[model samples]
Target: MGINLQKGQRISLKKEAPKLEQLMCGLGWDVAKKKGGFLSGLFTTDFDLDASVLCLNQDGKIKSNSEIVFFGNLRHYSDAINHMGDNLTGAGDGDDEQILVKLPLIPQNIHKLVFVVNIYNALERSQDFSQVENAFVRLVNLSNNQEIARYTLSGNGYQGKTGMIMAEIARVGDDWEMMAKGEGFQVKSLGDVMKLYS
Candidate 1:
């Protein structure tokens, strides 16, 4: 069936929706100085960082140690899908990982796609000390390379913590939409992030 989408319309999906064919997820952050810096860039600087999209999966179930693709810059990007090792760090400008998941075809069972931020290292600190910002995910139609839906994590709830987020992307009528939800935890490792699914 053909998918229908309206221009500039925001869509949200439920958790139990089918998986999408081509998924395009991006991670971004805002790097601003928290305090004053030196004229020569030698002073202490703070960044208002936030990870927008953390968790995203197609209709198929994401297994352990999957290769997820991380594209875009600290702010945004157009080309390149950087491959990252599972449980690794994509820190710094233009640092990201693209995860490739292999799953069995489950027909309509793979209806929803979930996006999350793996906060496995920022639980003990306070929100102000936490540096996760501007994270988000988007569904792309592989057939046309068109972005169908997207979601973002904002506000104080996303200030600081080490955990994963849950965003559902499902088919609405013919097109798709994104539903974002925050799930906090004292994540110590990637195993913890995987535990959410288990």
Candidate 2:
């Protein structure tokens, strides 16, 4: 078990799990179940939530498309981050997707790694965070598979939103820190969120 983080809470990875060289970021979400709506029992909604990592430089901006790792680009140029493919449907249990990070291999210029999730083809699918539930991001120490911390969110607060800025792992001096953002955005896709850093 690990600390159940609250939104905006930040923790020092170095202090929590010393000698943490490798990390696994696991993200999960569930589709909202229809409640007593007409025809609700006849159809089940499918969700394709994408988890991405935006590697920002010291100036808090993205310099190239290579810095963003997602289903399309699984590995970072520096080999510090790797996204574990895409999960088309938010089905089954446990983490729907995972991203592996090698702390020591991170590039010197990269100061922050922002974790984000967006509905795939949100505009076309007419889907939003309002149809999602039990969204969470958690950090695990890969060495022993121990959970370091977790941040969870309920979709009830993100009505009409299409994307979410979940959390961030930031470099602070010689240590790494993790912060739970849990901020929802109206952006349509991951590319729209990338524009924020560009």
Candidate 3:
């Protein structure tokens, strides 16, 4: 059957090992200006970066290491970068670093799933003011992995930098619906994402 979705309907998944269809996935972030001065909002605070992916499954849970790949440019780190072990730091210029995720098989009876961004480590460092904060995620229905919808996060402020961009995804009818929720703590690692639902 085909998928049907409402405006604000919640999604649920209840089976194990559901057939996951990865639609369109990508990453977007705001880069600080190079020549701009102090008042230009250049090197005052952290720079915001967000990465995301899309998936649909019978089960609600995804593997921890599911390969979530993202395509972009190396505006920051140009040296010593490759398919694996790419370090994305607050430096250089434009967009850099292609993130990947290996998701786990989801659980049954779960309607929606979300992935978040964390920036606790960036917050503690004073010298790392160039790193941006409040990045987010979105999921689109791609015929061959193209763009579709935009799931933007909430609870963002001028000073509120570094946190999770909630990827609230739900199974609407036979298809899926997602909402970008920017809440919770600034994660330092992927392992900290486990506390999202808790």
Task: State which candidate has the highest TM-score.
Answer: 2
Compared with the true structure, all predictions reach lDDT values of 0.41, 0.93, 0.39
Which regions in candidate 1 have their CA more than 4 angstroms from the true location?
1-20, 30-32, 37-95, 99-113, 123-130, 170-177
Best by lDDT: 2
Ten consecutive residues with minimal summed lDDT in candidate 1?
71-80
What is residue 137's positional error in candidate 3, in angstroms? 3.0
TM-score of candidate 3 to 2 decimals: 0.49
What C-alpha lDDT, on a 0 to 100 scale, does residue 111 get in candidate 2? 97
1-198, model 1: which lDDT tens digit per residue? 222323233354222134544444544343334445456357434332233322223524444333222222222121122223332343465324333222222223244445555542344333232455545444454445555554444555544456545455444554556555555555654556555554
Worst 10 residues of 2 by lDDT: 152-161
TM-score of each: 0.50, 0.97, 0.49
Pitting candidate 2 against candidate 3, the one with the higher TM-score is 2
Clash number for each model: 39, 0, 34
Against the true structure, candidate 3 has what lDDT? 0.39
In model 1, the Cα lDDT at residue 122 comes to 45
